[model samples]
Every structure is written in structure tokens, then in C-alpha cells.
Target: MSWRTARRICRPTARRRRKAQWRKAVDAVAGGIERASAC
Candidate 1:
């Protein structure tokens, strides 16, 4: 396989993983906000 093609394949996988991490972080922060408001 060409180097460029291999990189293109990897790029989306890396982006998806990063997006998943950001989502988890956002959920945790939102939960914290809710907990604080309840206090």
C-alpha cells in the first residue's frame, strides 16, 4: 500500500478516538455541574 493511503486510513480512526474522549470528558463535566447545582 502507498504511504499516503495508509495514512488516510489511520487518520479517521485517530479522529474518532479523539472525538470519543472529548465526549466522555464533556459528560463528566456536565454531571459535575448538575451535582454542584443540586447542593
Candidate 2:
């Protein structure tokens, strides 16, 4: 595949992975806060 085609495919996958990682981080923080508040 051409460089342009490769970039187009890889860019979205990278973005999706980054988004998933961010969501996981947010969820972990939220969980921690909830646990702390419950105490």
C-alpha cells in the first residue's frame, strides 16, 4: 500500500487506542473516588 493509504488506516486505529486508554484511565480515577467516598 502507498504511504498515504497506510497513514489513513493507521491514524484512526491509533486514535481509537488512545481514546480507549483515556477512558480506562478516567474509569480508574472515578472508581478510586467512589471507593474513597464510600469509606
Candidate 3:
């Protein structure tokens, strides 16, 4: 595949992985808050 084609495929996948990681972090923080409030 050409360089352009490789970049197009890889860029979105990287972005998606980054977004998933961010969401996971946010969820963890929210869970922590909930637990703290419950105690």
C-alpha cells in the first residue's frame, strides 16, 4: 500500500484507541467519586 493509504487507515484507528482510553479514564474517575460519596 502507498504511504497515504497507510496513514489514512492508521490515523483513525489511533484516534479511536485514544478516545477509548480517555473514556475509560473518565469512567474510572466517576466510579471513584461514587464510591467516595457512598462511604
Candidate 4:
């Protein structure tokens, strides 16, 4: 496949993976805040 075709196929998956990581990070921060407040 050409570079452009490969990049088109790969880009969304990378973006999705990054979004998932960001969500997980946000969830972890929220959980930490809750725990701190509960203490």
C-alpha cells in the first residue's frame, strides 16, 4: 500500500487509542478526587 493509503487506514485507530487513554486518565483522576474527598 502507498504511504497515504496506509496512513488513512491507521490514523483513526491511533486517534481512538489516544482517546481511550485520555478517558482512562480522566477516570483515574476523578477517582482520586473522590477518594481524597472521602478521606
In order, what lDDT does every prediction score?
0.98, 0.97, 0.98, 0.99
Per-residue lDDT for 1-39 in model 1, tens only?
699999999999999999999999999999999999999
How much lDDT does candidate 3 score?
0.98
Off by over 4 Å in 3: 1-5
Runs in model 1 deviating more than 4 A are none
Give each model a TM-score. 0.82, 0.78, 0.75, 0.83
lDDT of 4 by residue, 1-39 (tens): 699999999999999999999999999999999999999
lDDT of 2 by residue, 1-39 (tens): 599999998999899999999999999999999999999
What's model 3's lDDT at 10? 94
Error of 4 at 34 (Å): 0.8
Global lDDT of model 1: 0.98
The full ranking of all candidates by TM-score, starting with the best, is: 4, 1, 2, 3
The reply for model 4, stretches above 4 Å from the true place, is: none
Candidate 1 clash pair list = none
- Two-way lDDT contest, 1 vs 2, winner: 1
Candidate 3: minimum summed lDDT over ten consecutive residues — where?
Answer: 1-10
